[model samples]
Structures are given as structure tokens and as C-alpha cells.
Target: MTAWAVLAGVAARLCALGLTASAAWLIARAAERPDLSALGLAIVAVRAFASARGVFGYLERLAGHDAALGRAAGQRVRLYRALAHGPLPAGSRGAGSGGGEALTHMVADLDAGQDLRLRCALPAIVAGVAGTAAVAFCWALHPASGAVVAAGALAAGLAVPAAAAAAARRLGARLAGARAELAARVMDLTDGRADLVAFGALDFATAAAERQARRLARTERLSGGVSAAALAAGTAVQGLTALGVAWAAAGTGAVTCAVLVLTALVALDAVQPAIPAAQLWVELRPAAARVRRVVRADAALPPDERPHRPAVPGRVALRGVRVRYGDVPALDGVDLDLSPGRSVAVLGESGAGKSTLLAVLAGLVQPGEGLALLRPARGLYQDAHLFAATVRANLLMAKPDAGDAELRAVLDRVRLTGWLDALPEGLSTPVGAGGRGLAGGQRQRLLLARALLADPEVLLLDEPTEALDAATGRAVLAGVLRARHGRTTVVVTHREDALGLFDDIVVMARGRVELHDAGDRQPIGRAFPSA
Candidate 1:
């Protein structure tokens, strides 16, 4: 399809060149003799070329856009799938951080790659073919004029664009950086507006955003200036080249000279867009590099290459498990064993690696130097995410084919049955962005219901009852444990009331397991001295 588009574009430019030359010849010939009959074939040929030019130009645009859009769609799907399945490596800031700024930048980069095919490569290819044809046609008519036209075409099509591209390359990185910074600042202002106002920092945020906006505007002005200058230079070259063609063909008859000069002028039309195309080519390079880096990294460490799901879904063991974030260790030389159908509660202070341990079990964070073997597990993190979707839609993420009965059962298990029943729309009620419509406890219960619906062999809960009141927290915890009677479960929490219900209790300090005891005997505060 792309080849067809390029061919059509080249054909259209050639037709345009023919139309200009033929019209000039017919007018000059009729002026010499005042005889319309002598110019009949020339007039007919001019109209034919004009008509064909318009038709082929339309076809070229249609085919070119179709091919480019299809390619963009495919690339977007592959990139999204790669990011969805795994965590990006540490310190690698691709799509994970930068929030909407990163996502919008990535999408713009993909569009740039698509435009390279339609705008840069296609125009350059078409111009080359059409310019060569014009030079050859002029040579057949008058050899001396041919040389002059060829020189001008080469200067306009090659030298000017190359210089423009080189200049644009110098500014491309700075322009890209400014745009990203602006995007980040705008997103920060939007997402943090409430917090900024509460802390009396709204003015500070506004000033920062204005600074980034100014930088972006300055960079854009510079880029536009470069593009305009390059275009003006190309047009100047075309005018001088047209004059030279006419001077060289002066001895060939007035009619012939006029025809060749007009041909030279029209041939330059094909080269006029080349300067901007070259600038775009240079501008797309950094974005392409960023995209390729992410795609290549994703390819190197595929998400599916992790440890397989255990066959019997019973024991989970980790030995000498270690994970380092930069120089500091988040989990260091930790060992744990979870027996089948037993509940283990991990108690720790804020940064005691309890969450990291759960991540290791859930196969989210790979161990640096250790062995971790576990069955398929579903995790409910302390900050569980909820989309801006309906109640049923969110629940369907856990089990896509679940009916209303299954959904209602899981909601009941999490003690959200009464709350959901009281709603006007029940399962159909909308959960606003990040579950904004619901209270913190309601959101937590919904997340718990989702995890339960998944029914994995192992359940990992990170502060699952943190959002609820004392009475409600204890009831929800009991219900969760009861529902998982025959499955392995790991709970990471600071709460003490639920500690007695677990079969084993593990306390973590720093990055290591400090104590492990049977839940029945040891007091919660004694096990966790700081707590």
C-alpha cells in the first residue's frame, strides 16, 4: 500500500510538470502565428495532464494515510502489551513515572514515526523521481538548459534540505525536553491542585508551570524560524535556477525557451516540501530512540519468563531472598515458609520490607539473589487501584465471566452487601475515578471482593483492613480468613486485633525477619516491640 502511494505521488508531480510546460508552449506558439488549430494537440495534452495530476494526488493522500494509520495502530498495541505484563527495571523511567506526561509523549513519538513514512520518506522519494524526469525531459529539448535546471534541482532538493536537517538536529533534543517538561508541569498542576491549595502552594505551582510554558514557547519559536528560513532559501534557489534555464535555452526559439523555463519552475514545486520533510526527519530521531529503548528492554526481559505456577498450589518458600533499590536493600536475606491451608500475618513498621515480601510472593518483584517458589497468587495492595467504571465492570476484572450471583457472593464475603444494596443502582452504580464516589472503607471492601473473586491458590493481602473501623476491620478480616479456609494466605498489617486469628505470625525489622512464632502463644506487642 505504501509503495502504491509513493508511486502515485511521483506520477502526480510529473503530471504537474508536464501541464506547466505544455501550457507555456501552447501560449507561446499561438502568440507567434495567431492560429488556434496549430496549438490544438498541445492544449489537449495540457488539460489531460492537469486532470491526471488532481486524481493521482487524491489517491496518493488516501493510500498514504491508510498505510500510516494501520502501522501506528499495530505499534501501539505491541507497546502497550509489553508494558502491561511487567514492571520496568529500576531507574528506567519509561511509562512508569512522569504520569500523563510520559504517556502523551510516548503517543506523540509514535505519531512522529508514522509521519516519517507519510511526510518525509514519501515526499523525498516522489521528489527524486519527478526531478530526475524533469531534468531528462529538458535535456531532450535543449541540452545547455538541461545542465542549469539539473544543478538548481540538486541544490533545492538535496543541499538545502540537508543543511536544514543538520540545523534542526541541534535543536531537536532541547525542543523535546522542553515539551516534556511542560507536559509534566501541566499534569502536576492539574492532579495536585487540591493539595497545592490546602498547603498554600498554588502560587508556587502556577509560577513553575509558567516557567516551563515560557521555555516551551521559546524552543518552538526557534524551530519555526529555522523551518521558515530553510523554505525561503529553497524558493530562492528555484527562482535563480529557472532564470538560468531560460538564459541557456535562449537560442532554442522563443516558444521552446518558454516551455523549458516553465518546466524548470514547476519541477521545483516537487522539491519545495523537501526542506520541511528533512526537518521533521531530524526532529523524530530522539523520540524514535526513546521508543526503541523501551521496546528493546521489554523484549529482553519478557514477563512470561518468570517462575511457573506451582502444580499443587500448597507451599510457598523463600530462601535468602534479597532485593536492592539502588545501594539500599529493601529486602535482605529474608527466609519464609508458608504451609498449605494456613494463614500467616506479617507485622512490621512502615519501612520493614513487609510489602516487598508480599511483592516477591506475588511474582511482581523478582528476588536479587534467592529462591522463591509459589503457586498462582492474587494480591490486594494497601493502595489498591480502581478504575473509573461501573461496579460490575470493576468486579469483572477479577473474573470476566462472573455472573451477578458470583459478584453478589464476593461482595457479601467482604461485608459490602448492605452498602451495595442501599445504592440506587446496586451493581450498576458507577465508581468514579480511583473509586472517588465511595468512602475509603467502601473502596477497600470492593478491592477485597475483587481479590476474593479471583480465587487464586494463594492470597496476598497488604494492610487489607487498614481503612476500616475496629469493629468492621475485625469482621472483614475474619470473613476473609474464613473464605480462604483451604488456601494459603499472607497478610501484611500493623493491626493487632487480627493477629490472633493467624496460624503463624512473622515480625520484620529493617529488611529481615526478626521473629516467627505460633500465633496462639505470643502477644502481638511482644512480637513487634515497636508496635
Candidate 2:
């Protein structure tokens, strides 16, 4: 995309043009048996041009790839930003949210976009300039030969490529979706391999993956066939052009005729890239369209124009809020208020809307009716992911600028101080993906440490101590509540050990609050409903 890369491409192409022309001239002129001294210049010229061609080509590749990669990096950032706000790419929501399908969009689709600039546009521009110059050079030698070369260049550079592009355009429409489907299928098999084996459904998943692969292969085969046809047509055109030039130059001397015909043949190289470039352009079109759809969809969403409700730090209020999924309500007519520097415990069985209430307060889910006002909030879900990185790296994700002391403090707050000191690399110790290397309790603690690092105005924890032993769970919860003292915190928990730490307790049933009690007034056992 950079001007320097384009210039380098042109220079490289011109060098190729010169190398072929000079070599042809040298061979033809040497046949006259002229003085060895005269032949010396041609020999030197041939070598010089040949070497310069490689040098310029290397430079072109270096500069071109650098430019393409840089542009792709920036485009990737834009794509992420768009995806973050946009309607997520297909298969990037709910179950398997970021599996193979999203990976295809992020990686393969972006690669196709980069190919548009690096392979399609750059080659086409260089080919046009160098091929035109070659045509002009031929015209200087003889008008008839020039006419023949121009026609051949047009056929090779435009006509054949155009035909290929037309065919590719239709196939490309299906190619992007097919690739994504295949990736999703493959990822499904991989991610669910253990479960599939356990359930004896591995063969079924494999069969499905094979079917997708076949579909994708069929589309690719068709595209490859088109490219092959275009390549053959371009080669035929090159041969015909060389014959025409030779015939047109028959009246001229043998040396001149040889030069004209050979130049015409070699010059076709400059135009040759157009065939592949056209096909590449066609392939890129679908990918570009998909990316644009994501970005445009985000743009189409109405801005958050809701007037701000007057609220202080950590204050949250929901007035007759309701949320539903089809016929089932997750939250219904729920009215509650959370003041600054207060803590609440939300207790309920499954499907009682405890988690949904936290979702509302965190602004992750919008209520279908009534008002829900909240300040900045962060939630530590039960399924928080720990990346396959160092302890420091994982913690830094919550607060990027956090120093060693800050990280240590958060770890201490979550009662991981002894564990942190035991690690061979201390903060630099690496953890496995999804916390594979760490115990269940340690993973939960590490995630809690990350959530607490930011010390948000409002903290929401959805069953944070679910994975720990009863004793450890109680201790960790106590430590977390102590650290979150004087801050608004809402915790979803079934455990009764940490009840006294909260200012209030909310008990819900069937999406409605059944009881609201001050923590100190009610017996912990009575707070929960009888079966």
C-alpha cells in the first residue's frame, strides 16, 4: 500500500523486462561472429541486468510484505474494535462463542483482505506500467511488431484475467461461508473431543466434519479449475504474440527480427501476473464484504442516547425492571436499590434469577421494562478464563499498568500470598490454558485477584467461591469481602458461611424477589426456602 512498495514493484518488474531483453539481444548479436571485444559489452550487460533483476525483486518482496503486514495489523485492530461493539460475527455468541467460526473471520478473512493489497492491487499496477513500457519499446523497433505485442498484452493482461475473475466471483461468494463452516465444524470436534469420546459420538462428529470438508473442497476445486484455465489461456496468448511479432518483423534483418520476437515473448511476463491478481481480487471481495458487514452493523445501531440518571459512586437502582427470553421471564418487576459502600448477598436456586439480577446491575443485560441505573461495574463470573501466560501477564490483563506491588497486593487480598511465594518463578510462573495447571481453588483465587485489581466502584461476583473446598471458600470469601469493605458489592452465592459479611440478603423465586432481609436479623438457615 505504501508508495515506496509500489515503486519497488515497478522497479523489479522493469528489471525483469530488461534482463530478458538484454539476454535476447546478446545471443542474437553474438551470432554475427563480430569481434570478441564487441561481444564483451553484451555479455557484461546480460549479467548486470540478470543480477539487478534478482536484487530489485528481493527489495520489492521485502518492502511489499512489510507494508502488507503493517496494514493488516491496523486492519486487525479495527476488526477487533468493530467486533467488540458490532453484532458479533456468526457463531460468536452463546455456546462456543469464539470457537472456529470466529477464528476464521479473525484470521482467514483478514488474510484474504491483506492479499487484496499485496497480491492483487500491487501486481496489477506494476504489470500495467511495465507492460505498457514494453509495448512502447517494441513500437520503437517496428510499428507492425508493436501492434502485435499490444494485442497480445491486452489479451494476456485483461481478457483472460477478466474471464477468470467472472468465474471466481460466483465461486467466491460461497467460498467464505464454506471455509467458516468447515472451521467451525473442525473446532467443534476438537473442543468437544473428550466429551465425544466419552459419549461414543466421536464418529458422528468426525462424519459431520468430513461432510463440511467435502463441501469446502468442492468449491475450492471449482475455483482452482478456473485459475488453471486462465493460466493456460494466458500462455497460449504469449506464444501467439511471439509468432505474430516474428511474422511482422520478417521484412527486417534477422537480428532485428530476433530481438523483436524475443522481447515480445519475455514482455508477456509483466502481464502474466494479471491473471492471478484478478482471481485474488475476486476471492478477496467476499471477505471484505463480510468485514464491512460487521463494521456497518455496529455503525447502524443507535447510540446510547438515554439521559444519565443522577447517581453516586457504587449506587445502583432498578425500578420495576423486567427481562424475558421468549415466554420465560429471567427477571420480573424487580425493584431494588444499592447504596454506596454497601454489600448485598443474592441467594437463590437455579433459574431463580440471581445471576440475571447481577447481569442487570452490571449492564450486561438490558431489562425489557422499567429503569435500571448503575455506575461503572465489573463482574467475576464462575467461568472466567485464565490465559496460557505468566501469572504477571494474567493479572496485568485486569489493570495493564499495575506494578509488581499492586499485583502482589491484589493476590494478598485474595489469600494467594503463600501460593505466589511458592511458585518457582514467583510472578513470572506460567499457568496453563484455562487454568489447567492450577488447582480449582487456585484458579478461582487468581481470577478473584484479577477482578479485585481494578477495585471497581461496583463489584459483582457470580458464585466466585463455588470451586473451592468449604473451609477455603469461606476464608477466601471473608478476605474478599474485607477488601471490598466500603465499596458496593453484590455476590451471588449458595454458601451460608459468609452471610454475616453482607448488609442485606435477597432471596428470589421464579424471577421475583421473595424476601429482602437485613443480614443480622434473620437466621442464615431460615433465609433460604424449604423444599
Candidate 3:
């Protein structure tokens, strides 16, 4: 399809040149003879060229856009699949962090790649073909005139555009970076609007956003100036080429001279777009490089295969586990053993690696210097997401083949059955993206219900009830423990009041466990002196 588009584009440009030359020839001949009847052939030829130019131009656009959009769709799917199966960087757990920015930037890069094919490659190919044919046609009229046209075309189409691209490359990169920064800042401000207002930081965020916008505007203006100057230079070369052709064809027949001069002018039209095409090529170079890096990264990973199922349920052990974030250790020399039908609650201050421990158990983060043996586990984190879908649809993610009875059973286990049944839509109630339609406690309960529906051998909960009140948190925790009585469960929480709910409690400080108590009679605060 793309090849046909290019061919049609070249044919359209040639028709444009032919139309200009034929019209000039007919006018010159009519002026000499003052007889329109004798120029029937020329008149018919002019009409044919004019009509074909419009028709082929439309076809070229239709075919080119179809091909480009098709490729874009394929690229998006490939990129998404690669990211899904690939190993993500440490500390980037969800799209709320820098992952969203990275994905958005990659998408923009893919778009730029498509634009390169459509605006740069296609135009360059058509211009080269048409310009070559124009030079050959001019030579047939007069060799000296052909030499002048060839030299001018080369200067206008190649030299000027290349220089313009070089000049705009740095500015284009700056503009792209500024645009990305502005978008990130805007998103950050929007996401943290309440916190920013409460902390009196909204003004600072607005100022930062304004600065990025100004920088982008300035870079774009400079790039536009460079393109305009290059275009002017190309136009000047076209005018000089037309005059040279006319001078070289002196003393020839009026019709012949007119055809050569007009063809020279029209041929330059084919080359005029080359300057912008070159600029776009330069601008897309960084985007191309980014896309290449992502593709290479994806290729380096092995293809995803089905995971091996666990032989037995409710067993998780980590020996001498350690994880580092740069020079600092997040988890240091940690060892844990979870037996079947046992519940362990981890209590820690902020940054005490409680969440990291849950992540390791969930297979999200790899230990640097230890061995981990875990059964199939389902993790419910504070940031668990809910898509803009119905309640039934969201629960189905945990068990795709689940029926209405199974869905209701899990919701009932999580104590959400009453509230959900009261809704007019019941299971069909629509939840907004990230559970925006639900309250914080409702979202947490919904996530718990989904995890219960999965029926995993091990369950990892990190601050699962943080959004609920103390009474509700205890009730929810009790219900969750009751529902998963036979599974090995790990819960990370800061609530000392709920410590009695677990069979064992582990207190952590810095990156190591400070105390471990069994039988659930220990005071949680006494184990952590710093807290």
C-alpha cells in the first residue's frame, strides 16, 4: 500500500509539472497564431494533466494515511505487549509514578516515527523521482538549460534543507523535552491538588509549569524562524533557475522557451516541500532512537510462558534476603518463614521496608542476595487499581470464569455484599477509573473481594485497610482472615490496635526485624522503641 502511495505521489507531481509546461506552450502558440482552433491537442492535454494531478493527489493521501495508521496500530500493540512481559525498573510499581510519563513519551515517539514515514520519507521519494524526470525533460529541450535547472534543484532540494535540519535539530529536541516536562508538571499538580493547596505549594507548581511552557514556546519560535529562512532561500534558488533557463533558451522558438521556463518553475514546486520534510526528519530522530531502545529492550527478554503451578499451597520462605536502592539498603539480611494456615502481621514505621517485604513475597521485586520460595500469591496493595468498568467486570479479573454466585460469595466474604446489593445496579454498578466512583474504604473492600475471588494459596496485604476507620479496619481484617483460614497470609500495617487479629506479629526498624513474637500477646508499641 505504501509503495503504491509513493508511486501515485510521484505521478501526481509529474502531472503538475506537465500541466504548467503544456499551459505555457499553448498560450505561447496561441499568441503567435491568434487561432484557438489549431491548439485543440494542446488544450486537451492541459485539461488532462490538470485533472490527473488532483485525482492522483487525493489517492496518494488516502493510501498513505491508511498505511500509516495501520502501522501505528500494530506498533502500539507490540509496545504494550513488550512492556507487559518485560522486567520493569525497581521502585516503579505503578503508572502513578514515572511509569506513566515513560509510557506517554513512548507513545509520542511512535507517532513521530509514523510522521517520519508519511511527511519525510514519502515526500523525499516523490521529490527525487519528479525532480530527476524534470531535469531529463529539460535536457531534451536544451542541454544548457537542463544543466542550470539540475544545479538549482540540487541546491534547493538538498543543500538548503540539510542545513535547515541541522540548525533546527537542537531546538526541536529542547522543544520536545520542554513539552514533556510541562505535561508531567501539569499532571503532578492535578493529582496533588489538595495537598498542594493545603501546603501552600500551588503557586510554586504554577510557576514551574509556566516556565516550561515559556521555554517550549521560545524553542518553537526559533525552529520556525530557521524553517522560514530556509524556505526563502529555496524560493530564491527557484527564481534564479527560471531566469537561467529562459536566458539559456534564447533565440529558440517562443513555445519552446516558454515550456522550458515554466517547467523549471513548476519542477521547483516538487522540491519545495523537501525543506520541511528534512526538518521533520531531524525532529523525529530522538523519537526514533527512543523507540529503537524500547524495541531492543523488549527483544532482549525471553518470551513469556505459562508459570509453573505450585505443588502445595500456603508455604512462603525467604532466606538471607536483601534488596538495595543505590547505596542504601531497603531490605537487609531478612529471613522469614510462613507455614500453612498461619497469619503474620508486619508492623513498621514509614520506610522500614514493610512494603518491600510484601513486594518480594508477591514476586514483584527480586532479592539481591537471597533465595525466596513462594506459592502462588495474590497481593492487595494500597494502590490497587480499578478500571472504569462494572463491578462484575472488575471481579472477573480475579477469576475470569467466575459466575454470579461465585462473585457474590467473594463479595460477601469481604463484607461488601450488603452495600453492593443495595445499589440499583447491584453487581452491574459502574466504578470509575481507579475506583473514583467508590469511597476509599469501598475501594479497599472491593480489592479484597477480588483477591478472595482469586483463591490464591498465599495472600499479601500492604496497608489494605489504611483508608478505613479503626472499627471498620478491624472488622475487615477479621473477615479477611476468616475467609482465608487455610492460606498463608502476610499483612503489613501500622495499626497497633489490630495486632491481636494475627497469630504472629513482626516489628521492623531501619531495614531489619527488631522483634518477632508468636501467640499474639505482645504489645506492638513495646517492640518498637523509636515509634
Candidate 4:
């Protein structure tokens, strides 16, 4: 992929060089009467070279785009898998991350990086190579001409650009920082739009956007100012080169004059496309730093690649399992064993590490201190996501070949049969973005359906019914009751109403197990008459 990408960039540049040389050659011919056959043959040579260059240019773009998009896709998939190996904060990895929306990492940053790679660096590097060689060739034609070309090449491509780039760095960095803050703020505002509007902060969000726009404008001015300076420098050099070539040609005559000036003009113009790409290098550093931080973040994640899944006998045990974010331990010295065919409840207020514990259990977070053993379970996830795909597709995500009848049966068990039936496409109805979407309840149900489809022997439920209403929540709870069947289910929830459902309940406070007992409440007796 890297080879293909590099080649593509080189090809686009070859074409540009051929086009410049052809234009110069054609101008030289227009002034004289060369033989018809020789002129025709020369024209054919340039045209063929230009045509071949264009073909390679197209191929280069195709290959580069594929490489870039493929790399971005791989990065996203790796990120998603990495997220799977631990817990996503707030249960949903798609959104609510402090970094803002997943798109920031997945689309925006990736696109920016890829653009720099394909459109800027490769082409500039290619042209730099070709132009350097061309300048040397022109010098061999005339030593004085060679000296001028070399001087102009370094001055235009290196010296001026270096100085301008240094000047633009601070302005560019500030603008980049502003853009990042704006992107994060946009994500935050979008996530909390309802709260913002209800609290009458819509104006504030708008003003925030405006402020970002103003900063962006300032950056634009800075960039424009830099580019304009580059043009001025190039024009001044070209004008001076033309005068020098013309003055030196006074002894050599007009033909030599034309040749030197033409060479100078062609080589000077070669630096134009190169200038922006060179500038982009200066602009892309901060973004590169941001992406590097994300990539290197994984390096700090302790390798938890256990060669084999432990045959943990129908019970989960966290032996001194601890996890710290920065300096604060989210789960510290935690210990527990969740047994088979039983439901355990973990209760804690926000920031008491309820979600952190849940993440550890789900295998999404690595404990800073100890081992988290999942006993006889595939995995655990909270508020799991469904793609912008069909209801059937979402369910099939767990077990792709599980039959439509099987799907309907699970939906019926989850009490979502009516919901699916009401959909325009029934089981095939799309959900999530750009689809015949579901509400929060429906989305959660689809997630639940996905989990159940896995037929996990032990169920880990993290606030599964939080999105549902009183009656609906109860119905979902009843579904869990039926679904639990012989499987052990560990749940983290706050509602006192769910106390009856568990065979045994464990309450957690500040990463410590506070309550571990069978229910004393009569609701369990009524709900499970046989028990």
C-alpha cells in the first residue's frame, strides 16, 4: 500500500514536469521553421510523453486514494477492537467520549492526514527530485545558466519557504488549536443540545461556533499572507532571472537568449505547485502530534493478550484487579466472584466507579493492579452499538446464520416483536443513522438482541433498562427473567425495583463490595413463585 501510494504521487509529478517541458518546447518551435516531419515527430514525442504521464498520474491517484482509505479503515477497526479489549467510558464508544464524536477520530483526522500524504508530500517530493535534475541538465547546457537555475531552485524551493513557514507556524498552531477546540465543542453541543436549549444556552453554542469561525478566518489570513509572500518572492526571482538571461545573451544573441529565458521560466514555474505542499508540511505538524498521541496511547496499554481464554468455571473473579486513569484509580484492589445461574447487582452513585467496574467486567478496561477473569462467557458490553443497518442485520451481527425464525423468536422473547412489526420493513427495517431509525429504547433492545444472539452463558447487564419507562422497563426486566434461563447474569443498576429479580445481589460503593445477599424483599417471592 505504501509503495503504491508513493508511486502514485511520483506519477502525478512526472506529468506536471512533462507538461511544462512540452509547453517550452512548443514555444521554441513557434519562433522558427523546423522541417515539417521533424516538427511533427517532436510534437508527437511530447504528446506521447504527456499522455503516458497522465495515465500514470491517474493510476497514482487511484492507488493513493485506496491506500489512504484502506489505512483509515484499518485504523478505525483497530480502534474499535482496542475499545473492545477494554471498556468505553459512558458505555457507548460511538459518542460521549471526552474527545467528542467518533467521527473526529474516524473521519476528520484521518482525511486530513491522508490529504497531506497523497496531495502534498508525495507530489512535492517527486517534483523536487525532477526539478533538481532538470536544473542540473539546464546547467550542463550553459554553465552560467546552470548557476542561475541552481541558485533560483534553492532560493525558491528551500530558503524562502523555510523562512515563511517559520513565520506562519505560530499563527497556524493557534488556528489549529482553535479548530480542534471548535470540533470538540461541536460534538459536546450536539450531544447536549436538548440540555443546552432547555437551559437557554443555544445562543452560547452559536456564539462559540462564531468564535471558532473568526479564529479560522484569522488562520486563513495568515496562510493567505504566507502564500502571497511566496508568490511575490517567486515573481521577483523570475523577473530578475529573465533580466540576467537577457543581459548575458547580448553577446550570445537572440536564440540563446530565448533558450535561457525559457529554461528559467519553465524551472521557476515548476516551483508553484511545490510551494503549497511545502507549506502544508508546516501546517500539518500539530495535527500529526494529535494523531500520534492517540496512536501512542495504545503503547501504554499493558499487553493483556492472554494466549488462551481461561476455563473459569461458571464464575467471574477479579483478583486484585485495579485500573487507573492518570493518577486516580477507577477500580482499585477490587475482588469478586459472580457465580452461575445467579444475578448480582452493583450499585453506586456517579463517579463512584460504577461504570469503571462495569468496564472491567466487560473486558473493555485493563485493571491497573490485577487480573479480571471472565468465567465461561464470550464477553460483556454495556449499551452496545448497532450500525446504520437493518434490524435483521443488527440481530445477525452476533450470529449471522441464525435463521429469520430464530431472530423473530428472540425479538418476541425481548418483547420487541410489535416494534419490528410496526416498522415499514419489518425485520429488514434499518436503524441508526440514515435509516428508518429506532428510539433509544429500540436501539437498546437491538443491542440486547445482539448480546442474546451470542447466547452467552453468563449475561452482563449494565443499566439495560435505563432507557425504558416504568412499565416498559418492567417488561424488559421480565424479558431478562425469561432470558436468564440457566445463565448467570451480573447487572449494575440503581433502581430498587430490580432487587427482586436477582437470585443474589451485590451492591458496590467506591469500588468496594458493600452488599452481597439473597433478597429480603417479598417481591422476589412473588416474581419467582417456584424459588
Taken over the whole model, the C-alpha lDDT of each candidate is 0.80, 0.79, 0.80, 0.66
Which lDDT tens digits does candidate 2 get at residues 185-236? 8987977798999999999999998999999999999888888989999999
CA displacement after TM-score superposition, residue 344 of candidate 2 (Å) = 13
User: Is candidate 2 or 3 superior in TM-score?
Assistant: 3
Clashing pairs in 1: none
lDDT of 2: 0.79
Sorted by TM-score (best first), the order is 1, 3, 4, 2
Clashes of each: 0, 0, 0, 8
TM-score against native, each model: 0.65, 0.56, 0.61, 0.59
Model 3 lDDT per residue over 1-531, tens place = 389899899999999988998899899999998666789989999999999999999999998999988987887786675444332333332322323455777788889988988998899999999999999999988999999999988998999988988898777668778888989999879877889999999999999999888888888888888888999999999999999999999878888999999999988878988999999898786676666654454242233311123434566667898999889898999988777778889987788988888877665676788766654433333337787899999989878999999998888776788889888899999998788889888998998888878776677788888888888888889888988758777898877888888888888888887777786465666666432
Model 2 residue runs over 4 Å out of place are 29-48, 65-116, 166-176, 182-205, 282-531
Model 3 TM-score, all chains together: 0.61
Candidate 3 least-lDDT 10 residues? 300-309
Better by TM-score, candidate 4 or 2: 4
Clashing pairs in 2: none
In candidate 1, what residue range of length 10 has the lowest lDDT sum? 84-93
Candidate 4 TM-score, true structure as reference? 0.59
Local accuracy of candidate 4 as per-residue lDDT tens digits, 1-531: 477756665555555555655555666676676667656755775787778777887787787788777876776665555443333322232333322254355345556676777667766676677567657766766777767777777777777767777767766778768888888888768767888999999889979888887878878787788789877987787677667656654565555556667766766666656666767777665454444444444463334423123355346677787777888767768887777677776666665677777767765565667776665534545445666778888778688899999999888766798988888988877786523356777777777777787776667777887888867777777777677667777777766666676677665556666556675755332322111
